[model samples]
Target: MSEHFEPPEGGNKKVALLIAVLALMLALAEIGGKQAENEAVAKNIEASNLWSFFQAKTIRSTTLSTAADAMEIDLAAATDAAMRERMQKRIDDWKKTVARYDSEPSTNEGRKELTVRAKAAEHERDNLKARNENFEIASGLLQIGIVVASASIITGVVILAFVGGGLGALALGFMGLAMFAPHLLF
Candidate 1:
């Protein structure tokens, strides 16, 4: 009498499909994380630029006020009409620019809007920074989870292999080591 043994069916293909699925999921997660990071950096850049612009405009307004005050004192001491006219024209130009800025439809709304947006963006930047920091921590934790999971999976495979191969040998009396015996022995 001959004992015919058949190999397991579809085992390799099933394992291959599972591995591919896990890989795809991991890749998609990585892409999502990177895209979120890019968006955060972009928001941070806009916030930084707006903050710098706000500082510059504040400085410009203060300097213009100082210059106007100095010119007023100088005009009181001066008797030259031509010099007075030139100085007055310079002051007028500054006033006109201010008026133009106020009246301009494009950034007239945008000036106020930008100020509001700048403040919001600054808040958003801080949030994004914290989000990225949290993401980093999460990524590290996810990496550890994957490593541990992979180790557990490998250990399961090893246990299966030892049971399948060693059990067959033990059943045939090729290995008599009691330590390698099946669960029934224990």
Candidate 2:
């Protein structure tokens, strides 16, 4: 296939323009889709890491709480006042550490804070996924529009150009929705 792609003489030139415009739109759609997909993947990884940290914090808090309870039980059987006092103080320290792990608002590294952060990341990933899907659909429609517009030039079927133009217009709407109103686009 060594044929040159020269434009046909006369009226069909408009269809060639339509094909060019549709191809440009397809490129834009693909770019947006790829960006959204990449962001979604990053957000997903962030959420996963946050959840794992939250789980580790939860385990540490539980272990500390259990140890504090056991120490308090052992302290009751101690006859020496000094030993009982030391054991009570150590148990109090462990209880405070367990509370800090459960909800340390200042550090934002506690189990409760991590849970909130992970949920937020998950929400962002979901929205990005929806936007990517819309862009993908727009890209497909624009590609088809380009094909149809090219066919109109070859077959001299003027009506095919209008159909292709309609498809391109629809694709534009999808692209706009993906950018501005992704929730609605999804």
Candidate 3:
């Protein structure tokens, strides 16, 4: 008597390839998620630092004064030929700097932290409204980055799942890392 065994229908090579793809995707997802979280946390820290910077000083006098000084050169009041030109140039320079400040990120990270800090400052006292507005204006770049990074991470996860490998485990590990980062970091 002779006995024989049949090979599985699906190619093991294909299955292995699929598994590899899944593993890669899972790794990507894990990395992306961690980066997104880290970026957000870093941004938050920078924002907090910015807020602290402003809080430590008198906002109305410092930032606004510098900005205003840059803005007002008394171009109309002509003391002399060179004075008018100098004043005009000064005014232009001030406008440029003020515009930059207006367009900068509140914290080094961007608006998410700035916005949160601003809202908190606003609810607490009237004096902070202006500062919050400043922070909000500065937050644009970081905000866009954060949004993009988070979206990419979410999309990566979806793709990892579709690849159907050991992603489920990887995702669980990622979540655990995310939850524990703060404690681990500090």
For model 1, residues 1-186, the per-residue Cα lDDT tens digits are: 996543357544443444444444445445544665676688878877776665666566567767877887787887999999988888777666544433345663333455776778766655554544444443443444444334434454533433333333322231122113212222
lDDT of 3 at 86: 72
| Candidate 2 ranges beyond 4 A from true positions | 1-10
**Candidates 2 and 3, the one with greater lDDT:** 2
Q: Model 3, which residues run further than 4 Å from truth? A: 1-10, 59-186
**Model 2 Cα lDDT, one tens digit per residue, 86-128:** 9999999999999899899999998889999999999999999
TM-scores vs. true structure, each candidate: 0.54, 0.92, 0.32
For model 2 the TM-score comes to 0.92
- Best by the lDDT measure: 2
Which clashing pairs does model 3 show?
A: 104-138, 105-138, 106-138, 106-139, 110-139, 111-139
- Per-residue C-alpha lDDT of model 3 across residues 119-186, encoded as one tens digit per residue: 55444332222223322322332233333333333444333333343333444343444444322322
Worst 10 residues of 2 by lDDT: 3-12
lDDT comparison, 1 vs 2, better candidate:
2
Better lDDT candidate (1, 3): 1
| Over 4 Å off, model 1 | 1-22, 77-89, 96-105, 108-114, 130-134, 157-186
Estimate candidate 1's alpha-carbon lDDT, on a 0 to 1 scale. Answer: 0.52
